[model samples]
Target: MLLALRALLPFSLALLFGCSSTETDTSTEGAAAGIALTETGAHAVTRSKVPFLWREQAYDASLHDSISIITIDQKLAEELTDAERAALGYVTTFIGSECDWDGKANPEFSNLKCKTLSALKLGYQCSIEHLGFLQHWFRNDQEVLIQLASCPRIPFTASSQQTFDEIYLTTQGDTINVWFSASGVNLPMNATWEWTEENIFLAQDDAISLVRTNKSEVIRSELKFDEGL
Candidate 1:
């Protein structure tokens, strides 16, 4: 059964990070506020009339050395297509948005903290599950951080609110794969990255892919109902 299940879940996934617009002007005023975002957050951005009621995702990060996987069952694409769909749901409704969840700059995120983790880890941590699959990261999505912030600590279950077992991040040019272990599990992915400049948020395009392999009988799936963020 374990082997059979593993065979069924054989997968490869990628995320192209970057947001185009914003939905809110957090420029209201705050001590942390550095500059009003050129882009609005998701709240201010208008979406299609539909919300995606179903979706699934798979992810592999070389830096984190983890492969996060998920599958969504019983989706209501038509109904989900309605207004105010979740970002992941919106992406499912339109795959074109796979690269970004929120717009590049939101006024609320003007003075974000310094990125502690290296670009590799930042990128890996940024890699997030969408529609149960991971096509992007949750680096700056306040709504996501608030709702699913607990996921990282939960046991690495594919079910609701579970943590990822192993996370991986591969250096640029397919030269190295950095591994970060959690709960004794191996990292879930081998990734490729390219660094054009030293900046963290450099405006460039690169494909992030990750995968995981295990000996136990674990289930990977995407559920239609949201567990939040």
Candidate 2:
């Protein structure tokens, strides 16, 4: 499964990032907003509509691996063109990771991405799943942080699983911040911690769901917001 996913990554990256226009934009407004620009000076952008729904597949400790899937409702899926659906799945695969094992060394950083599990089909809803390798470092004494942010310019790769430290939810203007922390950080290093944040630009009814699995137990949380950023 891992090898198959790897083989498809290059094609996926091209399909996801190849459609941008070659024209350059000298507008100062874009620069002030921290928008990324490509080598050609064109804005690096994603066609994804804001507010994604996340679904985590069951975790198997024996294999030290798991999958996270994202999907849209049948109604929303119907409205998107084939290209749009593929882009949406492609972008959601990027994830940020910070892990502190043994509470002695600095946290290790990595990236993760979801692969196309089941694209649009007659009997299947459009969906993508990320296959991740759970790091053995995860323990009750260590801290692990996983992040999923929208509108990413590039995809990330990494996979690990453990227990979540804490779940936090806060709102800053129009964006919602969701932080997950654990108890094993080394005080001397003062390493930065990351969280999940989504800018609600469209689709008022859209939401994000988090699923955490530890052995046979599973905990799920859903976040919904009313305003747009």
Candidate 3:
């Protein structure tokens, strides 16, 4: 995960949904979902779930072309109890640690120093809050779709509030955005997952596509895991 030090967005959010699109451009549905990684099959592989999520750009093999799923440790999932929120919060800490909390209370793309967990979490919080401040963007069906007249030129704030912006989290290792509710509003967000080459010890990436019901296809991510825990 440390190698992903350069990939992160500050002040992010997560609001996942289970519904996905049926379009065949790499269906991100759950057949791609439900992973139970083990010693032999520990390498990062791509899987597709039931519902296919939407993407601004159809398919870019250059970027992560498939959703990465690292099986969650049953013990941790049980121990965390509040895995949903707590896990997401834990991921937030990463964005903060990476961005170094410029202390401006605003989302700045240049704050790419996200090399630590604490920095990333702070960065996620700051960036998400700023995104929530956008007008004409809101959540429906527990999922959020942001829309702006024109996307921003800057990578960080360029599409923070745009409908078709290509959003992602490097700290989460090239995972797409997650859906979330903050300040009582549902917004598209990101979830973070941490792995030690093979095992899924932690997951913070929480985008709208990671839902348990009526899920959308836009939030699914993948793990290009290494072989061994």
- For model 2, the local distance difference test gives 0.26
Off by over 4 Å in 3: 1-28, 31-81, 96-229
Whole-model lDDT, model 3: 0.25
Choose the strongest candidate by TM-score: 2
Q: For residues 167-211, could you state the per-residue lDDT of candidate 1 as single tens digits?
A: 222222212122322111122332212111110111112222212
- The alpha-carbon deviation from the true structure for residue 6 of candidate 3, after best TM-score superposition, in angstroms, is 17
- Tell me which of candidates 1 and 2 scores higher on TM-score: 2
The C-alpha lDDT values of all candidates are 0.23, 0.26, 0.25
RMSDs, each prediction? 20.8, 20.3, 19.1
User: RMSD, model 3, all Cα superposed?
Assistant: 19.1
Backbone collision tally, model 3: 85
lDDT ranking of the models:
2, 3, 1
TM-score, ranked from best to worst: 2, 3, 1
lDDT of 2 at 103: 27
